[model samples]
Target: MTADPVVETLDALELVDHHCHGAVTADLDRPGFESLITEGAAWPGVSPFDSPVGLAVRRHCAPVLDLPRHAPADVYLARRAELGWAEVNRRFLTAAGTGVFCVDTGYAPDRVTTPSELAGAAGAAAYEVVRLESVAEAVAAGGVEADAYAEAFRTAAWEAVRRPGVVGVKSVAAYRTGFDLDPARPRAEEVTDAARRWLARGGRLDDPVLVRHLLWTAVDLGRPLQLHTGFGDSDIRMHRADPTHLTDWLHLTAGTVPVLLLHCWPYQRQAAYLAAVFERVYLDVGLTLHHVGPARAGAVLAEALEITPFRKLLHSSDAYGVAEFHHLGALAFRHGLAGLLRERLDADELALEDALRIARWTGRENALRVYGLPDGSPDDG
Candidate 1:
């Protein structure tokens, strides 16, 4: 009963998955649905979301197909139970040589209810849950609600950070599809007004309005903040997906508060640039790893590593279903790393120290630092 060497090596490294959306909802099951359809359909061996080739065919033929969405709390509990997060943590403790950091994500409306429940369920002493909330109310209040939301965020963030296992705040500012673009839309003006009010209240541009407020709040209270970056869902215009779009926020912050950029998709170059330019702008190369597989991921990672400081790079699965997909993502990430090492770095020249550093630093250390955890290795309880 020997373990696969690759699996064993990955296990021994104890990698930290910095960015992942562990919320359980049918919405997160989009990939699973695609897999099921592809598995059962006439066109066998065809992945609906397959890379460049499949993407081309899909663009030309099936462009804009609707996918299933999952419900929130129930989906989260179901997936966690199915994935055996508790068991996963135990196994992680056994395998992780250094340690692994798992940051649980919760959007605003959802966070108002889920965090307490999830904390009870996970039961691990050091698990972190980052909360997400809408800027809608804040926007309507004409900066009043925005200021209140900031205070609310601060209260929630500090509570979570101080909780037995909770670590930091995960806040999002923009909606790729939900918000109204025109003044005609109800409350649209409110949202925009709130943004203006928050800005007038000293909010910076490069920072997501909600996140900028949260970052300032978090930093003042001594907590870490994770912000969404790069391309989001299919509904979002690709142009808006660019992390470069946040240049104003970046310039405004100037590394004052540590920010973890989630995804960093097609805009890896821009992400890399931010990572290089701002000491606090850390990039999580996870969602892209899930959307684009190993080969492309290898190229992206190689390019990012070559240009960006290794300390700012983070690894994550960003997988939400049964732990199966999460494990798959981790394996895929390792394979991508191996490929990058062999193709870009000289063979046998990839030192274990560097590998360990990438695996540990990107995975957990940065997260631990951002979240302001006790200055010691993570302990699995």
Candidate 2:
């Protein structure tokens, strides 16, 4: 069968990966690469091929490294080791066709590229999204007294966001205390006491009161707040990470700032429900896309879009520690989403123009709008 024209058009559009983390700068032997692909947070000795994402790497990413498609996992790792880090990064990142990467620099700071290095490898521009948990941890580690922790965190956050290239802030509240905290901003004494208790206990910042404080601080700053919600490695209490749990806080912070929900899966429907009802909320099924791979990406996208307003959906890889994810994510989102819209066009359910319009909106335009990037859509002048 001839390729669908809309699918071809999608491949040409430049994507703004609105949420992602830095790629590894090191050369990986087999195990090292496997750890990056899985959500396990470590090399667990189990074969990476056992997971969908790992299988996806062998099937789709092998060719990008100059091997045959569906290359054996062992063969794939050997070819990758032969190519070395820089070449592998250059090949996959440049091929991803991403025009911008909004990078979160907090996670694995030493192991991954800085935002600038990532831009250089991909031949694209990048911006930073400060991670709140990292900043709070730094403050606690600096010997800030409990009474001073609140101001210390605010000052640090302000300085961090003001640094050149930072466009937003992110919270790992889901991974820390979950969204089940008090909806109201904690009282002054509550914050001070909570800081004292946490600090006394070596200051982990997972204290519910302090987490709520960090989130509210970001909201008050008025920059976008990217919250990790649903399907994070084994660290999260999956049940408590539900976006629906944030409704009270959502109501509290409504109209203060945009809350971008990252990595929603198994709860895309819940996320879509929140997006449908809350003007300040937006979501991406990035974790779902990369893990499920291109073959099944459409079904997830379809579910997310079922009750979501078109404008509220955004694209992200949520990829961390690898450039292969950067490539597969963009490829899957563009290819899979376009294929879904193409099916509708063929059945007379959607016009050709409508299909192309939706493809451009979801893959490129929505991110530009949500992240406040220039609309420079060709039609915009």
The prediction achieving the highest lDDT against the true structure is 2
Tens digits of per-residue lDDT for model 2 on 1-381? 987779788888888898888888888877677777877744456776777887788888888888998888889888888888899999989999999999999888448988899999999999999999999999888878888889999999999999999888999999888887788998889999999899888845699999989989998777889999999889899999998899999998887788889888889999999999988788998877988999899899989988888778888998788899999899889877987887777789888888888888878887777667766332211
| lDDT of candidate 1 at residue 79, scale 0 to 100 | 43
**Which residue ranges in model 2 land beyond 4 Å of their true spot?**
1-3, 41-45, 376-381
* Residue 345 lDDT in candidate 2: 79
Alpha-carbon TM-score of each model against the true structure:
0.62, 0.95
Query: What tens-digit string does per-residue lDDT give for candidate 1 at 112-176?
Result: 11333333333322355555443333333344454354445445556556767666556554333
Error of 2 at 248 (Å): 1.0
lDDT of each: 0.50, 0.86
